[model samples]
Target: MELLPVRPTIKTPAQAFTGDVYMTPIHSGTGPSRMTVALVRFTPGARTNWHAHAVGQTLHVTEGVGLVGTRDGAVLRIHAGETVVCPPDEQHWHGAAADTFMSHLAMLEAKPDGGDPTTWLEPVADELYEKANQQ
Candidate 1:
């Protein structure tokens, strides 16, 4: 067995998110493994841009309330201890609610070819975001 050292926290880039977001990578599988995991934190009103995963993604909320929205105008309010699963290639976005900080364990798999597993699209429009908060 190998013991992994703690990874440093880093601020998420503006190109992929709005407001303040941070992440600490947990595990990245090597060789025959494709699984990857990270702990992501979002400040109040912070959220990711529209994106999709090549192999789907799972998020387990660890603290505070958050929102997850899909392209079909469906918005879900998630709380600590809840888990949400997005199917492969389904466009979606997630983030903290308007008045609370949030954190979650983000788990997904890297493509077999070792390419980026996520396809990031435009940021969520303010109108839609506000509507999500209202939901």
Candidate 2:
């Protein structure tokens, strides 16, 4: 077992998210491991754009409330201790509730081909986001 060095949390790029978001890499296994893990934080109303993973992704909420949405207009409300498993290539996005901050552990696998594990799409529309966040 190897102890990884500490990594600084960095702001997420605006191109891939809305509002304030940060991520601290926990472990991003190199070589043949291909596993990626990180602790992500989202400020109120912050969220990622529509994206999907080649090998699916898992999110374990660690603080506050969160919202997860899909292309089908389905939005799921989650709180601390909840875990969401998104199937491979299932377009979706996750973020903090409009009135709360949220933090979660995100886990996924990188393709052996060295391509990006997640494919990002357009930002969630303000109208769509407001409606879904009306809670």
Best by TM-score: 1
Q: Report how far off residue 83 is in candidate 1 (Å).
A: 0.5
Candidate 1, residues 1-135, lDDT tens digits: the string is 999999999999999999999999999999888999999999999999999999999999999999999999999999999999999999999999999999999999999889999999999998999999997
The sequence of per-residue lDDT tens digits that candidate 2 reaches over residues 1-135 is 888898999999999999999999999888979899999999999999999999999999999999999999999999999999999999999999999999999999998798899999999888888888875
In candidate 2, which residue ranges exceed 4 Å CA deviation?
none
Q: lDDT of model 2 at residue 70? A: 96
What's the alpha carbon RMSD for model 1?
A: 0.6
lDDT of candidate 1 at residue 116, scale 0 to 100:
99
Quote each prediction's TM-score: 0.98, 0.96
lDDT for model 2, please: 0.94
Q: What is the lDDT, from 0 to 100, of the residue 64 in candidate 2?
A: 97
